[model samples]
Target chain A: MLLTDLVQELGLTPLTPQLPLDEAAGIERAYVSDLLSDVMGNAPGDGVLITVQVHANVVAVASLAAQKAIIFAMNRRPDENTCLKAAEEGIHLFSSSLPAFEIAGMLYRNGVRSLKE
Target chain B: MQLSTIISALGARVFVNHNSDTCEIDHIFAGDRMSDLLGAVSEQMLIVTHLSNQGMIRLIELMDASAICLLNGTPPCPELQEAAENAGTPLIVSPFGMYESCGIIYSLFKEDTSSL
Candidate 1:
């Protein structure tokens, strides 16, 4: 599904619109982790990342992984400075009140799958 | 997704990267030992560890990771943060401990056939 579709359907708060909304690429896989190494060692490129980490480094990791978007769970938001940097990088970011587990369920229902399996 | 987005998900604290340069992550590799990171090569990877210091930053720089996550609520000093910014490596400090952070990450990223 398109990112905009996911946002509209799931009611996720959009932090940045840097990424192209129409592309279906990188939307299927969803990786959620706070551990940066697990993400680097295993997460498949492209797809949205779900986690509670709100920092600039998160932006770097997402960019390198070629992820399509980032969904911050638990109603947590990144600081203003981080958001500005993300906007500069052309990365689309979103915030959700739902926790990771619920978000995963919502994603699965919406046709999103994991890249690892 | 841009590296910035992960910051949102992790609720991580950004120590540097004022320019917000667009960066993508290919994958993630978690390990505290620098030696382990050196042995592997991947595209745009994120390094997760509990260590936060100049040595850790050096390891990240050598690994060419897109970003670094400092777990256990440990904060890197200003010098290390500066090094990361100069190196163009994003740095973040997580509130949770390393193991908890890893577990949280694993739950969301790990998938089963049901999602399929």
Candidate 2:
């Protein structure tokens, strides 16, 4: 299943529903990021982005990179401004306190549907 | 369960809650080496490590991970916290060593496998 679908299945709330991450579909891979450059350098297209919070610039990155969803971590919640920006940008927003590493492990084990996979 | 519950189970100290106050968790990842982390992690994953630095933080940004757990009782540095705050990241400190802390958290979350 795609990260966006997983977020929905998990019954998580999104700070924004109009962002590119939220609107983008058929995402085949999952990518967890905390750094901007690393995502720029290595992340594949149409993947779910898992992070801690919903910042304004993250929407820019998602737009530029054409990501699928943004999952916030560390029990970090999104602010109203960030949610509005995401809705305007059409990015899928998800919040989880699971910590980046653990979430990644579960998704990987549960079968991260990569394009190649 | 709740992220706070997992952190408490691991005996980790919370420094900030950028968005985690309302976040829920399912599993976790424990490691310190960046080489091992790149291109092998998952979504909504929790990260546990002993290395707290700018490089690691930057890596986490790229990884798009859920949260971070600092082990060996290492406290978050001012720079680390500031960077995390700017990125809206959560940086928690754990007094337990890597093995013990991982064990505690893994058991609490009912997860045993590693991300790699």
Candidate 3:
């Protein structure tokens, strides 16, 4: 799904609105994990990450994992500095009230798949 | 999902059984970070992680997780194994990577759910 569509469908609040949604790549795969090491080692490139980790290291890990966007579950939001870092790293940031499992299930039902697929 | 069934599916080796082969695993929480696992802990949850340290055993014991499967065939140290054995927490080592292990288990979950 397109980034804009994902934002609309999931009712996600954009944390990095300055990043143009239209210019961003589409998301066909997603990995749900709060572990930065697991994400760095297993997450697919150019995919979306659904996690509850809102620290600055998340931005670094997302960038290293080549994730196009990250959805912070459970309505968790990082400080503005972290958001700025994400924006600087060219990674889109979104927030959702739903937990990571529910967000992943919704994405899976919408045809998004894990990295192994 | 029985712990033994997951062990067979992942081609995993059991280092500490704790007589938990028959334990029912109702959830799978895959992560390397203990803090993340801490929040999702349950008595029937199987933790899939790459961390093979004493802290993992402590987390398993503290959270009362059913079992913990270490991916990439990483074996726990003797101290860690002793800790798990002492705590009666099942420790499994899987030959598969984190992604493949989670995928296989997730497929099993899907099949089990669909059958019902």
Candidate that would win on lDDT: 3
DockQ of 3: 0.19
On a 0 to 100 scale, what is the lDDT of residue A92 in model 1?
80
Indicate the worst ten consecutive residues by lDDT in candidate 3 chain B.
B107-116
| Candidate 3, residue B95: lDDT | 83
Candidate 2: tens digits of C-alpha lDDT, residues B1-116 = 66777776766788868777655555566654475455446766667766688867676666666677776577888877776777666778877644345545655555523422
Candidate 2 regions off by >4 Å? A2-4, A18-24, A113-117, B1-116
- Per-residue C-alpha lDDT of model 1 across residues B1-116, encoded as one tens digit per residue: 45565566667787876433476654555554455456544667666765676677677566666777786566788887877887778787766544345444444445422322
Which model, 2 or 3, shows the larger TM-score?
A: 3
Ranking by DockQ: 3, 2, 1
- Misplaced by over 4 Å in model 3 are A1-13, A28-44, A97-117, B96-100, B114-116
Give all candidates' CA lDDT scores: 0.67, 0.63, 0.81
The stretch of ten residues in a row with the least summed lDDT in candidate 1 chain A is A17-26
- TM-score (chain B) for model 3? 0.91
Alpha-carbon error at B81 in model 2, in Å? 23
Task: Give the CA lDDT, 0 to 100, for residue A63 in model 1.
Answer: 78
